[model samples]
Target: MEFTCISCGNPLSESDLELSINLGSAASMEEDVDLSGDESPPFALDAIDDSETMNFYSTMCTNEPMAESSTEAMPLCERCFESLAGSIIHDIQRTTRETGRYNEAIDQLSTVTPPPPPDLTALELEESQAMAEFQSVQAELHKLRRTLAEVRAEAEKTTADTEERWRAMNEAQREADAACEAARLHAAVSTNLTAMLASLREDATLALFPIVDCGTHATICGITLSSNDWAETGAALGVVAFLISVLQKKLDIFGQFTVSPQGPQSTIAIERQGKSTQVYPLHMARPTKKGAVQLGMACCCLLHTIAEVYVAQFPDDDAVSFERDGHSVDLDDRSESAESRRPIDAINGLSVVPEPRGAPSERWDLSWREALLCLGRVCRSTATLDPG
Candidate 1:
């Protein structure tokens, strides 16, 4: 078993001095009665057991109880035992001196005079008045707190409502700006296209007449057709139908255009077969339709530009830039020739024409599928152009 000094935690062996302390018995020191005046010892040394040495040492040492047994023994080196015994003797002398001082203090207290007691009735009346004032102040403080809370709530609510209104206004302004931009683009493209195709209006109508003759057997522009041919032709027809649909939507927007309490409203509603109708704000619809128109116009412009270049190179042809009915029909004499001249003259004066832009030293050749794709690409490029 390992043993160490309780005070310093130093190693201890069997040969070390054994210092016994009984903390439980030491704690009962105050209960021991004095027998000095009767000529008898307060404790009879002969009646004590061998373990009673620890209790006697404990009573002569600290006032606090220790956790060990009343007869517990501690082993310490000779030097540690001498130091502890000296400390215990010094404490006992100090306690004896303190006891003498305490007795003198008690004799002085017995001779001193005491103050008179307070008047009960007057103190009771003052305490009651003070308590009443305190309660009244508490009630007023509580009322003020409630008022402050209500004011803060009102201020917070007002701030929230103002922020909500501000957000709504900003949203409406953004929508308005978008609508205006789309309308501007739509107006510009539609006007230019209407002017450019003014002469082609009659020709385009005549081109459709051939479709009626095509009937069950598919033939367009006097060429033999197959299912694929018909599908491609249908795609072309879809392009025309798309234009008419856009026009109808534009008319609807104009018709429904009005001012309300909320603000101005104009939108396009598209109905799909066997599906729910999709509605769009005018700003979104206009830009979308404008893109489609721009692509179609790009194809038209390319064709017109090509014809203009051919006419400039071969001015002696009896037929105008375009042929009709296997006979030469002069577009120069057409009523809209003045408007057509602008685009033609502009193309003729270009430093580089569209044809030379593709592969150098080779003419631009395109298959039917390639042509359709190229037309789409050209339209996208043109749509990005700033009308201004």
Candidate 2:
């Protein structure tokens, strides 16, 4: 026979999502009968054929005989199962409401009404009034006991509150103490830091002063300047070099200036330590630019000139260059020529000399003329004085 869901009438098979409810068999139902109350069985079962495994029993329900139970199993698909579950829940709620009503009826039955007092003598009535008074005193005693218990409980709560407040106050005090300690430490640190900064300022002033001062005054000149002064002048060149190196590393500017003896030629070239260097020869000349009398002086003057230009534009501690022997350079190039000529101050009166090329590029014959021309333009544009 084809089976359909009993709740939703959906066609169902073994493979489909389904539910099967197994009802108690007749044998199991017989076990529930109260045999001690009655000698006869509560239900009578009819015999079935050998092919039939199911049995049918007859029982009276509410003074009426029950209909025959179905032997075939009922199947429910997913949707039908959901609908049956809802019906079951509704039935349970209805049963619960009926149970509540039954409980209320039972409570009504449980209520007891004191029987009316028999005809009493005068002594018996007096005894009844005394007993009632005694009962009132007993109720009052019970009420007093409950009130005492509440008072004790309140005392315990108050004690706990006091202890909690004390704990909170102690914690707050600790936090305040910690804050004060931190403030003290910070003040000490600030004082120490201020002192340290003052010391560093003194040291930096002593170190950077000489280098910047010499560059600032443009006092570097070899002509008529003593050997000692020439050394200071050379130191000024080192300062300029150090500044340029820092710029190359930090900002990657490509401009470079170098002094070397060669046939008169001036050009720009890239120099590399462990890599390739490119040269852009702007102008090449074959003749020497200046005699030996002014070569060293010319170089010193050029370095001073570039240093003034650089410091004027970018005056920063990072640009401050110290020699390997520390930032101690005697900038007193007080030679007669350094004092009189002041090549940087007298730059306009100087002749155009070509930049010299080093031995490595001697064949290029770079001249210093263009370099001197460049310096002349810069000097005439700005009015700078030499320090006395």
Candidate 3:
């Protein structure tokens, strides 16, 4: 009869049959055998004859049920038998190891004593203390949060106040700068005005005494009185007298002698017992010896007045002295050297009577010219002095 492998349904070789017989025997005796120990094979191959092996296989097949309806005896092939034997061995080893571990667990359990139950009251007290600590820490954290908020608010307010103060300081600084600039401008304008006023004052004083020499003639306000004509001479004298009166009034000089000018017939008066008396006529169309004497006397008085005015106006200047009854004027330097005294003889020949008894003297005209020139020099010098 042909034998087939039970697992692969292929015809089995002789060697496969032998392997299957050994595997089948081992499976059948698996419970009784100590497979983990160093033991001999389940059955010796030498002891089993082919017929007996067949009988054993058949007997195993009978004992075990088959999936097919045919009740034939079948053995596994060599390859399938090896695979099945390896799986069975592996399962047995695993089961042996699991059984050893279960036995050790049972022994350990039997030797050990059980622990006592937990103390519920102590556990509850520890839990309550932990809860209290947690609450305390939470409260402190809340308070710290509130303090931080307040600190932040105060810091913000301080920043705002500082900004306000800085703005105020900046505004004040700007206003101060503007004020300083305005003051500087005002000071500059005041200085300019002061200089202008001084210049105008100097110009006005010079205008009041506009005396100048016109070639071969002396002029006052462009009027020449150098001619010997009686009317021209009289007019010149009258102008001189008028100027003297004006100077006296301008200088605020109130004295015993005063001049009254009336066109070409001007006169000088002297106070006698608090009454005014005309000393002399300054202009005369018909000259006479008596008139010459009076003219000389009047000229002397005028020179005295001029001297007084010069002294009052310029106290620090050299003193002017009259000599020869005002026929000559001199600047007295009051020095040790007599030559330091300078004489002005512009009016020297005015008092002298002419040889022909007053045929309009050329000396008189020359005298008037020199006198005008001298007066002009004094006025120009005065203007040059510092008003201060």
Which candidate has the top score in lDDT?
3
For every model shown, what is its TM-score relative to the native structure?
0.29, 0.24, 0.34
Model 3, residue 9: C-alpha shift (Å) = 9.7
lDDT comparing candidate 3 with the true structure: 0.50
Q: Please give the TM-score that candidate 1 achieves against the real structure.
A: 0.29
Position 273, candidate 2: lDDT = 38
TM-score-superior candidate, 1 or 2: 1
Q: Residues 32-98, candidate 3: write the lDDT tens digits.
A: 6554656645332222334554454444433344222333334777776566546545655676699
TM-score of 3: 0.34
Tell me the whole-model lDDT of each prediction, alpha carbons only: 0.43, 0.45, 0.50
Write candidate 1's Cα lDDT for 94-157 as tens digits: 7669989999999999999898889899999999999999999999999999999999999999
lDDT of model 2 at position 247: 36
Candidate 1 Cα outliers beyond 4 Å, as residue runs: 1-107, 208-388
